[model samples]
Target chain A: MEPYPYTVNPFVHQDRFWYPFVSPFDPCPPIRAKRYVVPPNQFLGFQPPNLLQFPPAQALMKGTLWPALFSPYKKTGKVEIKDP
Target chain B: MWVYEKKLQYPVRVSQCNPTLAKYLIEQYGGADGELAAALRYLNQRYTLPDKVTGLLTDIGTEEFAHLEMIATMVYKLTKDATPEQLKEAGLGDHYADHDRALFYHNAAGNPFTATYIQAKGDPIADLYEDIAAEEKARATYQWLIDISDDPDINDGLKFLREREVVHSQRFREAVELIKEYNEQKNFF
Candidate 1:
């Protein structure tokens, strides 16, 4: 059966302002949040509690080897294997 | 032969605006090594660049226009619907804090624009390296802005712009590689 509920991770905050893994930011106080600049009428969907809580469908693995199977260079290109 | 586009990607409308952010963005608009300078630098540099570098310079220069648009949008949104009381509360009620009625001609903040940022050294290597540095700096500033903002709208726009900087940096790196190739070929003769 399909999963009942979906969840999204909060850690995945992607934006111009948020530099992942390397930003020296000290969060402003909650007062700043109250007065935060709310954009006029932009709406995004709600975040789920736990992203990837359920496993991906079994059929997803079927095409995972597409690059190896249909690669243009798989047969024509030379593969040089050298001992290190 | 550039003409004005009479629209904004995202409306610059904000109920409560912070002047501080406006000022920083203005620095980006006209500040040394900022977008305006970057655009002008690359476009002008194209004239003297080798044929190999011509296309790369033109592409990078054109992309600067998009950066300019993004900064202008941020400034506009920060200034739109802003009230004097709100500006004062944000500690931005200075002689230069004229929101609600300004055109797209000032710095990221509300300061009078300056042309000090764009430098064309005439040396291709120097200018190309400078452009690479400028891309990294702009990316850093975008990171700083994202860190302070929780607004998803701004975040969405900001993320795209940041990724663009990364792409531009790669292009500049490629340009450098091409230049090195030309120099090596010349010396080999």
Candidate 2:
């Protein structure tokens, strides 16, 4: 007997994963191009302040990840998982 | 042009914050060799990069952003419950002493953020080599973080970040080789 016409396609499956409210496909919001333009007048050689010199203990952990805080698999990569 | 929908590759959950851990992870945010600096460096350099190095810089620069998010999440979580006692337990009392209960936004060691970490030099060969070094440094830092972390989940994330750094370093090295080959054929010297 033929299958019901309304039956879901077994070959096609929807990802059961949850997605974020924000979509990644959205184009990066446009901002004034000058926002990123670096000024040429500034002395270029000025060393970016090196903060690594202080002992690691001195560093503050203001915004790091917590062990049980989030699920690493909420989002998956498009790339296939091949044995490396 | 073919367009593939883009999305966050990982889900970030805002759990209870631990101020102490936040203070330490801040190192990755604005530290001298932190992910923030790395992202800014590669993104800025991409503009001046030759075609051969463009993809390399973009890929690496984007990855730095993920690292930045990871670090930021860590800090936020650690500080959610910023109690003096908890802070002490997390080994963040020293940071709290100076900052006085305020979680300052700076690099790992409370250093102010600056842009001097990156250099374009207008030379692809030189920049590509620098890129490789940058990746190696980041990889080393992630490895160090993993070594210090006692949490299994945190360690897993750190391990992944460390591996990514290695892959990026390899890519930059390849980009260097490509530039050399191009120059050799063009100059024929």
Highest TM-score: which candidate? 1
- Quote each prediction's TM-score: 0.59, 0.58
Q: Which runs of model 1 end up more than 4 angstroms from their true locations?
A: A1-84, B3-20, B95-100, B103-112, B183-189
Model 2, docking class: incorrect
Instruction: Identify the runs in model 2 with alpha carbons over 4 angstroms from their true place.
Output: A1-84, B1-8, B11-19, B88-105, B183-189
| Predicted complex 2: DockQ | 0.02
In TM-score terms, candidate 2 sits at 0.58
Local accuracy by lDDT, each model: 0.55, 0.57
**Model 2 chain B — which ten-residue stretch has the worst lDDT?**
B1-10
B133 in model 2: Cα distance from truth in Å?
0.7
- In candidate 2, what are the lDDT values of residues A1-84, reduced to their tens digit? 222235643222212222234455668752211111111111112223431242333211211122211112211232122221
Cα displacement (Å) at residue A71, model 1? 27
